[model samples]
Target: MLAMALSTAPAHAEDGYELWLRYHPLATEQASLYRSRASQLIAGSATPTQTVTRKELLSGLNGLLGREPTSSDTVTSDGAILVGTPSSSPLIASLRLDTKDLGKEGYLIRSVTVDGHTATAIVGNEDVGALYGAFHFLRLVQTERSIDRLDVRESPHIKLRVLNHWDNLNGEVERGYAGASIWDWWKLPDWRDPRYTDYARANASIGINGTVLNNVNAGAEILTPRYLEKVKALAEVFRPYGIRVYISVRFSAPMEIGGLKTADPLDPNVQHWWRSKADEIYKIIPDFGGFLVKANSEGQPGPQDYGRTHADGANMLADALAPHGGVVMWRTFVYSQTNADDRAKQAYTEFKPLDGHFRDNVLLQVKNGPVDFQPREPYGPLFGAMPKTPLMMEFQITKEYLGFATHLVYLGPLYEEVLSSDTMAHGQGSTVAKVIDGSLGHHTLSGIAGVANIGANRNWSGSDFNQANWYVFGRLAWNPTLASRTIAEQWVRMTFTNNEAFVKPVVEMMMGSREAAVDYMTPLGLHHIMGPGHHYGPAPWDASEARADWRPVYYHRADRNGIGFDRTRAGSDAVDQYAPPIAAQFNDVKQTPEQLLLWFHHVPWDYRMRSGHTLWYELVAHYTQGVDDVKHMQETWRGMDGYIDAERYQQVAAYLAIQEKEAQWWRDACIAYFQSVSGLPLPSGFAPPQHDLKYYESLTFKNVPGYSSW
Candidate 1:
């Protein structure tokens, strides 16, 4: 009925309420098979946790198969999918699935003969794993993968797959393009929305096991008893989906919230306070994931404030949680005003020397790029530098610098670029993926966290296309080795249509979306030229900011003679941090990849590029080509109007129109400004800017959507 209701509506008219969990009816034959095979769900006795799992199975099956599953206490002879842990179900215990190898969160799905009847069993070593198994089975049905002869066993390669929500207590999400924060802190604990269940369902579907609920710019009030009750309610909703809730804690919480004189890590009073706080949190939410601290960075307090090391700060929290099986994720995104060195190399300079000093429960969460999440950046050098420290890769899925939600940029390729980059930690094949997944470094624990794009928008992410970024981040976090194109194809099929005519072209467009964004926003390896504070559009002319790194001009260093920052021996010597082979490649402009040519070297405008055109000419061509590509994307989507639902079709069509206008704005503004400085003529046959550099620089937006801090 839900599917029929959705199908009958005009395609363009939407509440965006369903998101990717629409579960529209399958093809006739596929629907028939699914309906028959999933006619009943025979789950174990209902505990509070099992009740949650059973509800998800029933709801998801009803939506996809067009009928509710009949549940039973015992496995039936016909048409049944059994779900439970080994201890709870005899069917699961009989499978002898080598449960020892599953660790804590792995599951096994197999087509087996149960009590002389043909049935499929989703078995696990624990109840949480059973919940994970149920979601995996549902995913197979949603993606139209074959259910016959199923023999699937999966365990997350990374220990922690988390979405770090940059949501503040005020309900405004920082760099959040979708809408307001999902957490209704004011109504929580007393009033629980059913949408929280759906949020958990969506995450569980993708194997994302954890969520850091608050903004890294944390507030001390979150630790208060009243707020803990609200957090407990959220944690309860997420628990059945195998999703644990973590909180971003302010480093000064002990002093601010606990009425202490100082928040010193080594202070006996401070240590006792954190220990008691951890005890209180565990009492409310027993499986609380732990604390995510952004300390000694962006003015957040830390041990460094008291003349101590990062390890000192992180270890203090680790000691408090070690008894409760919790871990402390200490962010390594640090910079100091006193340091005259390049901002790119600051995190490494601070954390690398204290490699083995951290407690076992502490993980230094490092961003993928040494700098902030730029459009294109070399993998952070710290990935390989810290052999003894467990490092978790932090990636931004929200597109703060990559044109926010309005632009159709799939971040799969961006994530893959960093993950596959060789760190050369142990010579060849030492990729950043291997390092964070604990293979290269042989660390006991590992993780990959994505800054979530989710908000209160009915679509989950603001635009339909932005959903693919969230989908891709989860898929990559689960495996880390999946090809970006493959993930795009899967998402296209699941979210849009399985029709080859529609899927093929849509996926191809998605595969190239990120690169197209890079070309238009920051071409030829240039980084961080977007407007300061709200990084929505072009602001290369912007130079006024309190912090030097906060300014656009601090990054590009463009001028009348040449462009780009030189990180080579003659300049910052940042290249020296890389392995010798990679260092040599970046040191020479000719040897560096054309995509990254401007990142490592600043060249004369007249210098020749690999395209056989002068650097200035090539730059103009790339910017023009980026605009042209958006035109092509518009045309491609226009041709698909008849292929998808009118609602989704027109939604994308409208966004593509916005993209085209913005693309032109990016091209015209950037080219106009760059030409003013370079003093170069436009390449032959390229269209000239509609306005001069002064006009472009004068434009300002006082009010833009999604600019509110979280």
Candidate 2:
């Protein structure tokens, strides 16, 4: 019987290979409406970009309208959709659209007339822009939006919108949960997978203009000629889609791959080696999007290794790529485990002094938070501090800290929180969004990256709902000011059923997901208390790591006296890094926002909360609220049975069950550990842990995957 069970085949299911481009046949009424509006596609030229644009329109029209639209070079019908750049199509040129205002990657879609026939024209200054416009048109029909009076002008606000793949050379993704690396390095330069084109299509549809192919714990061999050939092949495939390829280079690559004695940024020989290497790379790939370096942090060699600063290291590389029209994204996620300093204060302490020292093309790629990607963290202090330099915001799309791929935590709210935060650099209204988008201090270069959650999984991201994070990342990357709830609605409409009955509840659940995780996992700015290496389940009792800061106890400092790390002037003085008003608020326990009260103050269990409950009671209430939220989500998902496919619906339902169990585990384990420390009883109505603290502590996971921290 056991042998028979092992031999059983998996059930047939709807694999998530299609992503959000699911142009399934629309409802009957909507299909008729779309068919009339999208009658024929007039693709004027046969450029690679235009060809894909036409093909995509045909595919989308055929799938959504239930009948393929006629393809032609001329306006053969009244509802012809003409698409091209002005230089490529005479009809677009005759329209005399103000394309001068639309940059290379911007497009204008208007309901216009050509050849005595009423038609919709999608015109751009370049072919890639038209391709983006084509995707936009398909999305409208797919989302069942009316395109009758279309006159939309669109462009990405930030100069660089990129996805940083934490993939390694060995087909292993550092923090990937979906599956193995998608790059398939061994098969790459020879076999161009059809998946690559689809990946490009997915990115281009949402205005992602760049991708880093390797992990920041970069291997030196990726800079070798052998891998450069492979990279060139990918460059060719992604060029038409307007995505430039960037590589995360090992800082000591000159020595690791070039047989140099030293990689000192100030060394003349090392500089020459990098300059020659840049020229060599440009000769093979002219449109290469420069290098991303992880140096002096996490044991990666940098200018600091040679007694030089970060500016020296970044400026050295910036000079090498300057002649090639490239830029260096020097990461600002620096900290030292060897030092007993506050982790929250390290990045700002290092980079704040060197603001005006970096070269013209160098951007300090700062993480969204001062510390690592916590469930809830204050916006990084560096956003408004560096007035003379460009700062790119980095967000982690992969849920390393939040229960990996299984938990349904949407990060849109987390991202929106950080982006909308007021850095207060120049008094009122100086938001982090304005700082990174080059509007705060009026700097030219700006970029934002989501450490990609993508992998070889059929669904792109591991689970069905996880794809919303990827979708929202792209949308928010295009325009930082977009409301996350609005993006959620757009995704729900496109990916799942557009029923009003389904969309509202689903969007509400998604909007609250991040906060729910915070309440259950690490509420009120408490962070990094998960399992030591794997970061799987709750481990508030962990303090056994070699480095003190890596342990959960070091972060929470939960004892009989109180709980929470004190970052005010009386403690680590980390609050001093923020602007004066913000600093003062964090310094005072009463003035500090309750959501971040514990982050700045270590209060006793008897301390009063804004809710009129003692700190201990409120904490228990929050943890209980988190578990209850999961139950509500389970009920909500159960009611959404008929809205989506049976396979995806059942998959989400099973995951919700897993999440409920995990949320309970988090609540129980954390509460039991805290109760042990505070010597306090559970609040009157709150339930006690299902098991003792020892039972939760004994639950060790030796093989939980996606634990890559670097």
**TM-score computed on alpha carbons, candidate 2:** 0.97
Candidate 1 whole-model C-alpha lDDT, 0 to 1: 0.86
Range of the 10 consecutive residues with the lowest summed lDDT in candidate 2: 1-10
**Index of the highest-TM-score prediction:** 2
Backbone clash pairs in model 1 (N, Cα, C under 3 Å; residues 3+ apart or in different chains), count: 5
Candidate 2 RMSD computed on C-alpha atoms after optimal superposition onto the true structure: 4.2
The superposed Cα distance between candidate 2 and the true structure at residue 684, in angstroms, equals 0.5
Among these predicted structures, which one has the highest lDDT?
A: 2
Q: What residue runs in model 2 are displaced by over 4 Å at the alpha carbon? A: 1-13, 708-710
Cα deviation of 679, candidate 2, in Å: 0.5
